[model samples]
Target chain A: MTDGDVMRRGDFSNGWKKSFQSLEKWAWRTAVDAAVLLALAAALAAGVNAWKLRGGGSGGLPWAGDWDSYVESKALAAGIGIVTMRELADRVPSAVLDARPRELYRAGHVPGAWPCPAGDVDASLAEHVADLDPAAPVAVYCDGAACADSLEVALELKARGFARVGLYPGGWSEWTANGGAVETGETEAAP
Target chain B: MRRALRIVLLLARLALAGVFLWAAWGKIAAPDAFALAVYRYRILPSWAVNAFALWLPWIEVLAALALLAPGRRWRAAGAALAAGMLAAFTAAYAAALARGLSIACGCFTLRADAAAGGWTTLARNAALFALAAAVFADAFFDRRRRTPSPENP
Candidate 1:
């Protein structure tokens, strides 16, 4: 057959076959390319996140800067003894801040400790903090290590500019453990 | 034709990359939640779930970035890797559906927002698989064009 005849006769079928083959090849190639793109993207994102997290450590996630700052401030306050946990047995005659529910406090508390549940401390600070001499030490304690009530209470106190706020991290458990004085009544001490 | 194919391939790569990057971020953001999702699938052993949670996102991210790189060979390798992951995910989802298990798909979010007992998850995975397939096809076609053989006659 002449080249022209062959080209015409084979044009449709041959071209169709070649096109199909090309398409098949293209589909396979694209699939491979996409797969690689996807893998690399995932790896980079994960690596960056992991690295940031690793660097963060106990400092907290990069997203919550405010939380980290708050934690740091509390730590500093606690470290400087400006905010500290006072042992009920110490009886240093400082302002005793109880960080338990009022009902729990009524059931019992350190004899001189005042009810200052962490939740209410923020709202009632004007009433409670006013009762204590600004210069006098403020001992904040909660239920125990398992409870973060004292930390919350201390944070509030510090925010309110109470220079002498203290967190008794060991709270009621420590008080009872040390055979500290206890009072069980709803007597509201004058602030 | 080559330019058109390249453009289509690039678009596919971007879409796949975006999906993988989002998935990885979601998992990394809530590793515990991802782990829970993995455990719910009941495919892998409980011990492996945590490790998968930790490493899978990185693998996906690496593959996505590699595909976007300038080197053609590296891009081809990346396409293969990504296709493998998509295939694995598709299989896992398919298996879960077959087992009649209601497991959350920890793809775009750590939170189980999608219905686990339905075809939606499977459909999403299938779409991803299709994209990977397209990428693979493009690379293969490009390679074939470059390496012509006497069989063409």
Candidate 2:
């Protein structure tokens, strides 16, 4: 090759090297920045969630992932009929039981749900759900699929000779996720 | 003309920032609902859904703030993150649509509605991606223009 050609080749090789270095630098810096931003976000989110928990704003997110699981398998094992959002909307159960804390129920719950938290199912049932006809189709739900309170309530209803017991696996979380209208405040506390 | 282009880019970037803040607000207010929305996407495992919901809004907020940072590096990084999220969302939407799943987009609101997850969402995401690309490209080219070439220097 001519002298000029040799110089051009060297220049081209150098340019390639420089370009590769620039790309490597850009990737490295961007990754570091993204990681740092992610860590900062995680820390901030943790703080906010902790604060929400303290104030009871987050409700009871006892289980994450499969939040709509309704502990479906458990409900099935107990011979409880499954309820989908579609079916719930179509039928609109005669009685809807909110198997969550009174505060969470007050904060935001399925419309027409009567609070019958898991801790005092018997008392809650007697106090809140006693008036409803057990023979009528009743739907039970709680925070989300991860919650077992709905199943507990459903099973309890069956034992109490409730003829029609259906379990809404999706629960409040699913309801909100599906854009269902939520009713806040007390739902006429039992006297 | 260059000044006009710069102004357009600036406004677009700001608009993106506003959208991000708005989206983050809904999610932050209703963490449970957001988590359920994420679960409905069905892309992530149940174990990871809550964590994703908890931290994703924060990431969006930080990225939006970075877009407004004074430094070029921060702005570029922020755009990169935003672009990455949009690309992932675009793909997810496409996949879900392909599978014939009609769910809420959860793009902005925590409350999942039937109206959100239409084919139009893909178009919206594409537009947002273009905005992010413009911001990122501005930072990338600005870097190259400011730095002297090794051979010349």
Candidate 3:
């Protein structure tokens, strides 16, 4: 019989009956297989993705790989150098850009550091940059390696046409670790 | 064997429906979290994510309900819809994996903290896909068996 003829004979009600009849035969095995196969596929996919993201290339997305290259190039053009806490202290004349929150900065900071929180860097950097020479080195730091505020502030500086934005990746923890000079009295909070 | 298959089919249907319902409720209740999850994937445009956040849950709920219904056509249609959703989710998950982004999976919520990563999410989706495939396969095979022989014709 033709496909159309078969369907016509069964119609909707009969079709349901037929479908259920087969369900009686293989429901358990089919359900088990379906569940197992799906679970396996999902697990494999999740594992691979997690690895790739943590691998890190300019924010973890593969398509955005060129971002690191861009950041590096900008860093070079801006004469920004990422220095360790010791290196930053050795260069006493440099200005420090504290990228932590205003409250943290007010509580304590590197002796010469200015309170420029990371979130406000893009907006506030212009006024500060206007006062300083673009070629003059500026050091940026936050809490520590676990924190990303410093990197973000550095990127913001780079974007704002400032060429000399140094990132102190070790940040405040490192400064304290290395016995760098710190000022404890409350500093004015950044607006 | 037929009886066993029927039990399996029923279980599969219920499981798939349950997942859809859970996911639908999640997205509907916490759209912002879902939107953020979509944003993290970085696939869809911001505008599209907003629109999807509004509508996707209802579609999922309806499809789940249809799949659980007894009508053959409704079951088939629901299976198709479920399969399509599963396929889309699979592709998105695969892409996210390739990109190496550890994003909160906004499957049920728009909150970043609510996101899950690693194998569990993938396994969950894969299980759903398999259920959809089984439903379709069962329907197809059942129809074939019910057909009369040429000699009878």
Candidate 4:
């Protein structure tokens, strides 16, 4: 081989070594940066969530408080049924549930309606229904027709073998707007 | 040619950052609602759901901020993070589809009316995945071309 060709080959080998070394360095640097980014993000999120749960200026997460009373109300009910405000007013023994968070439920709810956050429905429904007959009518509502919590709770009640579960489509907003009897508090006192 | 490629890379980076920032805002605003949405997916266990919801949005925000920062190293790190996040999402969506779960995308909106999970959701995630891949490719593939010359420096 010519002398120039030999030198060119040697140079090519050096170039390959440099490229590989640069790639290795880049990979190492990228990995370290990624670790830092992930740690910072995780720490920030955890801090915010902790603050929120501890009743930060934003008022204790989105909806937190009075879960026990809500569950107790559900347990005390005899049956579940769907009804409008007029129907609810007409039925003497119908058990009412506000299927939003305790905070929203405490703000205003159908008279004698107990808070039942939809998230807790699956876990708490069976115990609540044990106190009631399978055929008793129980009605549940949330924000309004647009909210899905009421429907979800109704389905759970039905699944739990409640014979007469019902969903009040209008929920809290409709009840208040129509001048239906309303109560606001953390207690689940009798209707 | 070089100028055009540089512009393309910059645009891709910005587009990724913008999309992620917009998504992070909604989730961060209503973390409880987002946690419920994540729970509904049934992919992660119940105990993991709230924790995942709490952390995911900040990760998106931080990665987006990094992607927007100048310099190849920062851009590379950001693109990798973005791609990794998209890939995780795509995998989760695919798993949900395979398991026949009816749920919402919960990607951008916390509203109950958010579109139900379906092929459309999968396709949307896949498109984002493609965009993330493009960002990653542009960031890493042209390192030699992007190297500063004495004249440019």
Best by DockQ: 2
Deviation in angstroms for B86 in model 1?
1.1
List where candidate 1 sits over 4 angstroms from the true fold: A1-191, B1-3, B112-114, B147-153
- Which is superior by lDDT, 2 or 4? 2
- Kindly indicate the candidate among 1 and 4 with the higher DockQ: 4
Whose lDDT is greatest here?
2
Q: Chain B, TM-score, each prediction?
A: 0.86, 0.91, 0.86, 0.87
Candidate 3: regions farther than 4 A off: A1-101, A104-154, A157-191, B140-153
Q: How accurate locally is residue A57 in candidate 4, as Cα lDDT from 0 to 100?
A: 34
lDDT of candidate 4 at residue A14, scale 0 to 100: 53
Model 1 TM-score, 2 decimals: 0.46
Badly placed stretches (over 4 Å) of model 4 are: A1-17, A59-191, B144-153
Q: Could you tally the backbone clashes for each prediction?
A: 58, 3, 31, 10
Model 2 TM-score relative to the real fold: 0.63
* lDDT (tens digit, per residue) of candidate 3 on B18-109: 88888887665554445545655768754565555545665677668767878544565567668778988877887888776555566754
Docking class for model 3 is incorrect
| Residue B91 miss distance in model 1 (angstroms) | 1.0
Residue-wise C-alpha lDDT for candidate 2, range B11-61, written one tens digit per residue: 978988999889999888877877766765768876888888889999999
- Ranking of predictions according to DockQ: 2, 4, 1, 3
Q: Give DockQ per model, in order.
A: 0.08, 0.37, 0.05, 0.34
Winner by TM-score between candidate 4 and candidate 1:
4
TM-score of the first chain of model 4 = 0.52
* DockQ, cand. 3: 0.05
